[model samples]
Target: MERVVITGMGAVTPIGNDVKTYMDALKAGKCGVAPITHFDTAEFKVKVAAEIKDFDPTQYMDKREAKRMDSFCHYAVAAAAQALEQAGLREPGSFDPWRTGIIFGSGCGGLPIVETEVVRLHEKGPSRVSPLYIPEMIANMAAAHISMQFGIRGESVCPITACATSTHALGEAMRMIRHGYQDIVVAGGTEAAICTIGMAGFQNMKALYTGDDPQAASIPFDKRRSGFVMGEGAGALILESLSHAKARGAHIICEIAGYGATSDAYHITSPDPEGEGACRAMQLAIADAGLTPADVDYINAHGTSTPINEKYETIAIKKAFGDALKSVKVSSTKSMTGHMLGAAGAAEAIACAMAICDGIIPPTINFVEPDEDCDLDVCPNHAVQADVKVAISNSLGFGGHNATVLLKRYE
Candidate 1:
């Protein structure tokens, strides 16, 4: 089997537009949540979210081309461009187009476009709806547009596993490379669902924080935590075989050591109370990495700030790590970036790779009072400097999808 390594990463997040700026904000313990300015929230119960600021699609692509894509696709392409540029693959012939591929993921794609087109149809006729609506509203279009942008012909896959979408994409991409199917894969997740319907749906489900305080709304693992703050962004990564990266002299960030995925046949919206499926996912990932619980140093948890998610995730961690759970440092970047839906896993994976490279652990900001059930080293409210060698990122989605990816410091 071939070894998969991350060569480059790109992020268009609520806190920052690029990886460096985003990581800096993470290290600084910055909170990106704010009052929603994209739409009027006067009639809604939820008023705040971690929205991307000052993002001009024109900066990434021409206005004419930008108009055709939904905001989700724009974020995906922009992040992919940044990752490709960093990997030195923007130049023609830098890599074989047929040997490279793209695998992007999204939970809710082009919801804004769908909302607009439906309203247009209701007001006028079907003829008034934009002809580009179907193409722009589809979830797989993110991967399709990325493939067209870079001329990658190997395989363009779009996994729609809800919150685990991008984590599944990265895991499946590694499998493709290991199976000799592709040499390189541009994989990640993007989400832009901060529109009216998006907020109303989650709010109605009681899965979102309805508080007005931006800082207090997304307090993950805290006793007073209400719910997750909805967020929108994209995160992209360039994963290449170790030999390929070394042959091209690419700057390798970290090695993807192992990946594990499992389904909880328990519930559609709620995690298994015992965290059986999630625990097994982590155990499998650790076993696949050929490491014991003691070998793991850090965890980027699927701590969505919701009471159920945080509590169940804690049980999962304890069940998986056992004695080593006390030694490992855990943190949830969601406390800072809100919940980026499909993009959460990819963005947190980037943070894990960076943590290994820089020897710094990002903080779970807004964690004021710790819950007894969620007792672990959360790196609460402040970043920590540590020699992190092996890290695992966990993502659990709707429909009980659980995915874990173990990353190791590139040797």
Candidate 2:
């Protein structure tokens, strides 16, 4: 198999717009959670979210172009542009466009646009609905828009596996590069679902944190954890074949060693009670990398700050690694960025790459009290500096969808 290496990364997260800003805020233990300002939350039970502050889409796109596309697509395009720039692939025409591809993920694609169109149709009749509604609301538009923007005609696709969307997208993109199907692929996830209907749906499901205090709202692995704090953003990474990267003298961030995906087939909204599915995914990723559990030094956990998820994920880690779990430094960057839904895994993957490159582990902030069931050493409160050779990022989405990606420090 051809080797796959990550050459670039870009993020438009709630905490920061770029990787440097994001990493700085994370290391400073800052929390992005605040009362929802995108829309009035007067009638909703959940009012807090980690929103992308001061993000003006017009900055990255023209007004006419921005009007036709939904916020989700705008985020995806902007992130992809950043990733491509960082990868030093500024001129798409210079490369074989046919051999490049795009695989972006979206869990709720253009949800706010759909909600708006639905209200317009009901209140102002069908004629009032925008003609671009269908194209804007589809889940695949993010990937489609990215392909169009970058002139990538090969294997344009989107993975919409709820929260696991981006992990699967990256994994699939890696597979394509590894199999000699593509030399370069723009892969990651984007989400902008912090609207009235989106918030109401998750609020009704009791999946959002309701704490009035922003700092205390997203306490993953803590005894006082209630639920995840919804966040909105996008993360994009540039994956290139190892030979292509070396030929271009591109700076390699890390190598995409293995990817594992599984389904619990157990529930629609909750993970497997025993974390069997998650354990299987991790084990598969480790085995695929030809590494033992002891080889993994850090884990960017799918710790959404929910009681059940934290408990079950802990069980899964213990089951997969046994005594090796004690030596692993696990942290939930979600504690700072909140949960980016479908984009969560992609954002966390960037954290993993950054960790391996900088030798610093981001912290799980606001971890006041530990849950008995979650007894692992969750690097809490502050970042830590340590030599990391290998790291794993895990994302578990609704419908029991689980995905894991193993990344190794570039030699």
Candidate 3:
């Protein structure tokens, strides 16, 4: 079996447009939640979101090309370009294109595009709809765009598992490289659904934090926590075989040691209250990495600020770590970045890797009045520097999907 390592990472998040800025924002406890600017929310109860800041898609692609794709695809292409560039991979000729893969995914792809085209179809008839609508609106188009942009032609796949989408992508990418199916894989996720209809859907379902105060809205693990605030962004990582990376004289970021996935087999939108599935998922990941609960140093939890989610995830963690849970530091960058939905996992995965590299654990900002149900040392409201050797990121989705990916400081 081949060892899988991360060589590069990229992100287009609400807090920052690049990896360095994102890490800085995390360390500073910078909250990106603010009034929604994508559209007017005058009559809507939910007023704020973590919108991307000063994004210009043309910076990554030409005007004509950018016009053909949706915002989600644009984010995917930009992030992938940044990842490849950092990995010292410029063009198809630089590496073997046949042994490359892309696993970028989106939870609700091109929702804004569908909203626009549907309105056009209703007001101006079906003939007014743009011909590129279907292609740009599909979930798989993000991966397709990344593959085409970089001329990578092998094993392109886009996995959609709601919030777990990017975690699944990263896991599968590791498997592909570790099993010798691909020498390298671009894996991550993107989402741009903070539009009128998108907000309406989540808001109506009571899955959005409707408070007007941006700073106090996304208070993860806090007793006053409500629901998640919508966010838009993309995150990409270059996972390559350790041997392949060393042979090419690439800078190794860290090793993706293990991955585990499971399902609650319960409700469609809620996690198992007992957290049995989530506990097992973490157990499987630790075992797969040839490690134990005591070996984990930090946890980048899927803390969405939702009441039920935080409680259950806490329960799951307690079951997984047992006695070691007392000393382990845990946090949720969502308290700063809002919930990026499909892009959240990949961005959090990047957070874990950066934490290992810099020895700084990003804090769970906006935390106040901690919930008794969530009894853990969730590094609240402030970042701390620690020697982080092993970190795991968890992502649980709407369909009872749970995934855990473990990363180890590459020695």
Candidate 4:
């Protein structure tokens, strides 16, 4: 099997639209969570979100094409274009069409469009619905659009494992390259689910932080944490076999050492309190990487700020790392970016890549109070600069899905 490595990354995130700016904002511990500006919120209990501000999709695609696609697709195409450009694939034919692939995904694609057309159908009857509704509403469009946009003809799998969606994309893409199925892959996830109905659904389930304070809304591992803050964005990464990247003279960012995925089969909406599946996921990833837990330098946790998630994730870490837990520094970027849902895993995976490359760990901001249940060294409120040789990221999704990927600093 060939080794896989990240060649380039791009992001349309709540904090910044590009990877460089996003890394800068993360290192500064900037909070992107703010008031929800996508729609009026008078009748809603949820207030703040990490919304992408002033995004112009025309910057990446044609005006007509941008208008035809949903917001999720817009973000997906923009991020993929940026990643391709950064990886020196600036044109459609830059890579072998049959040897290239894309695995981008969304948790709930075109959710805003779905909400809009449903509203129109209810108020103006079915005849008033836009003919573009079905094309814009499917979750697989992110992958399909990316595949068409970049001439990727090998594979286009789009997974929909709730929050684990994007992490699965990266992991599966890595497998494709590592096992010689594809030479290169554009992999990640995107989401634009901050619309009225999306927020209302999560809020009705008591899964979102209804509090108005942006700083306090998504405080993962903190005693005062309420729940996850709803956010919208996309993240993309270019992955290729180490040999392919080297032969193409690509600038490698980091190595994707291992990937592990498992299902809890325990709950529909919550993780097991003991973190059984989550523990094995991390252990499997570490073992697959041919390393012990002590070799890991940092962990970018799922850390969604929900009480049960934080508490049980802490347990999972303890179970996976044991005494190594005392030395491993962990943080949740969700404290700043809120929960990007499907986009969260790829975004955080990019954070892990940045940490491995730059040796700076982003903080878990607004961590003033510590919960005894979550006693890990969370790198609270400030960035920590250290020589991070290996980093691992965990993404635990609803319906018992858990995924972990390990990254090593490219030598």
Candidate 5:
């Protein structure tokens, strides 16, 4: 197999819209959580979320074009534009259009649009629904729009595996490049589900934080931790074949070493009790990289700030690393960014790359009290400065999907 490397990254997160801003927030340990402003949440039990603030889609796209797309697609297009620009990929003429591809992931595709259309059809009439509803609401439309905007004629697909969506999408894109199926691929995830229906659904399931304090609302692995705070954002990475990048003298962020995906087959909405599936996924990723668990120096954990998730993830880490668990520096960026669901894995992967490149581990902020079961070092509160050689990112989704990707610092 050929090698794959990350050439560029872009993010439209709750904390920031660009890599520099996002990394700055991470270093400062800033929390992005705030009261829901997208819609009034007076009747909802969970009233807070990490919504992307001050986003004006018209700044990134034509106002008329933006009107036809959903928020998720808009976010994806903005992020993709940034990633392509950062990678020095200007137009289809710069590269073979047939050799360029787009693979994006979305856990809930155009949820806000779907909710709006449904409400319109019910309250008004079917004729009142916009004709662009279906195109904007489909999960694959994010990838489709990105392809159209960039004039990419290669494979375009969107993976919808809940929270693990982006991880799988990135991994699959990496595989395509490694196998010579594509020379370059824009891979990542986007999510903008911060709407009334989205918030109410998660609130009814008790999957969101009800804490009044935004700072303490997303304390992963802490005794005070409640549930995840809903977040909306998009993250995109430009993956190129090693030869292609080398030919262009691209700045390589890191090398994609391995990727592993699995399913618990045990639950629809919860992880396996023992975290066996998660453990296996990480272990397989390590093995696929031709490295032992001890070779991993850092982990961007899927710490969602949920009680059961935190416990099971801890168990999974211990099962995979054994005694090496103590040697690894683990962190949950979600503590500050909240849970972006499908976009999380890609965002976390970017965090891992940033950690490896900058030699500073992002902190799991607001981690005051720790559970006995979660005894591992979480690099709490403050960022930790360390030389990270190899890093792994974990993303476990609802419906038992678990995905892990291993990345090594570019030498």
Candidate 6:
């Protein structure tokens, strides 16, 4: 199989808009949670979220183009453009257009737009709804827009796997390169689900944290954690085959060693108590990398701060690593960025790849009280300096989806 490597990364997260700002915020333990400003949350139980503040879409696209896209697509395009810029491959003449592709993912495509359009239909009748409603609301448009923007004519796909959506996209992109389907792929996930209907849906399910304090609301792996704090953003990466990247003299950030995906088939929203599916996913990823558990130095946990999620994820880690569990340093960036839903795994995967390159493991902030179940070293409350040669990022989603991606420091 051909080796795949990551050349560039871009992120539009709650804590920061670009990769540098995001990494800086992570190293500084800056939390992005605040009172929900996108809508009126007075009637809703959940009052807070991690929103991208003061976002100006015009900075990334023309005013007309910006107006046509949903906010989620705006995020996706901005992040994708940033990634392409960092890769220094945005020019049409730089690479064969047919050899480049894209794989983007989103959980709830354009809920905010759908909510408003549905209201327009109810109050002002069907004719009032915009003609672009379906095009803007579809989950695949994120990838479609990226393909159009960059003139990539190869395989373009959008995978929707709830929270694990982006990780699955990244893993599939890696396989696409390894399998000789394409030489370069722009891959990642995006989300914008912090609107009125979106919040009410999660609130009704009791999935969101109703805590008053923004800084302390997203406390992962802590005894007092009640629920996850919702967040919205996009994360993107430029992945290319090793031969292709070197031929173009791309600055390789890291090597994508392996990927694994599984389904629990146990619950629609809740994870399996034993974490059997998650364990299998991790084991498979490790084996695919031709490595044992001991070779992994760090793990970016899918710690959503939900009670069941944290507990079972710990069980999965123990089962997957066994005796090597104690040696791995784990942390949840969601503690700072809140739960980014579909984009969570993709954003954290970038953080893990950056860790391999920079030798710094981002911390799980807001961790106060410890729990016996989550007993691993979670790099709690502070970023740590370490030699992170090999790292794995875990993303578990609703509907029993589990995915893991492994990255190794480029030598």
User: Cα deviation of 189 in candidate 3 (Å)?
Assistant: 0.3
Q: Model 5: runs farther than 4 Å from truth?
A: none
Q: After superposition, how far is residue 318 of candidate 5 from its true place, in Å?
A: 0.4
Model 2 scores a C-alpha lDDT of 0.91
Cα misplacement distance, residue 263 of candidate 2 (Å): 0.6
- As for lDDT, the candidate ahead, 1 or 2, is 1
Q: Give a tens-digit lDDT track for model 4, residues 1-411.
A: 999999978899999999999999999999999988899999999999999988999998889988789999999988998899999986866799899888988999999999999999999999999999999999999888888777789888888988988988999998999889999999999999999989999999999998898888989999988889988889999999999999989999999988889999998999999899999999988998899999999999999999899999999999999998888999999998999989999999999998888889999998999999999999999999988999999999999999998999887
Error of 6 at 303 (Å): 0.2
The list of candidate 6 runs beyond 4 A from truth reads: none
What is each predicted model's overall lDDT from 0 to 1?
A: 0.93, 0.91, 0.93, 0.92, 0.91, 0.93
Q: State the displacement of the C-alpha of residue 345, model 3, in Å, after optimal TM-score superposition.
A: 0.6
TM-score of predicted structure 4? 0.99
Count: clashes, candidate 1: 0
Give the C-alpha lDDT of model 6: 0.93
Q: Which digits, one per residue and each the tens of the lDDT, describe model 2 over residues 1-411?
A: 888999888889999988888878877888999888999888888878999987777767788889999888888888888888889986856568888899898999999999999999999999999999999999899999888777888889889999999999889999999999999999999999999999889988989887678988999999999999999899999999999999989989899898899999999999999889999999999998889999999999999999899999998999999988878999999999999988898899999987898999999999999889998888889998989899999999999999999999887
Query: What are the models' TM-scores?
Result: 0.99, 0.99, 0.99, 0.99, 0.99, 0.99
Please give, for residues 1-411, the per-residue lDDT of candidate 5 as tens digits: 888999989999999988889988998898999988999877888878998988888877899999899999898988888888888896668778999998898999999999989999999999999998899899899999898888999999899999999999989998999899999999999999999888888888888898778988999999888899998899999999989999989889999888999999998888998999999999998998899998999999999999899899999999999988878999999998999988998888889998999998999998889899888899999999999999999999999999999999876
Which residue pairs come into collision in candidate 4? none
**Worst 10-residue stretch by lDDT in candidate 6?**
207-216
Lowest summed lDDT across 10 adjacent residues in model 5 is found at 87-96
Model 3 accuracy (lDDT, Cα): 0.93
Candidate 6 residues 1-411, lDDT tens each? 889999989999999999999999999999999998998877988989999987888888899998889999999999999999999888889888899999999999999999999999999999999999999999999999898888889999999999999999999999999999999999999999999999999988998898779877999999999999999999999999999999999999999989999999999999999999999999989998999999999999999999989999999999999999878999999999999988998899989987888889999998899999889899999999999999999999999999999999876
Model 2 ranges with Cα > 4 A deviation? none
Model 3, 190-239: lDDT tens digits are: 99999999999999999999999998898889999998999989999999
Candidate 1 lDDT tens digits, 192-302: 999998999999999999989998989889999988899899999999999999998998889998889999999889999999999999998889888998999999999
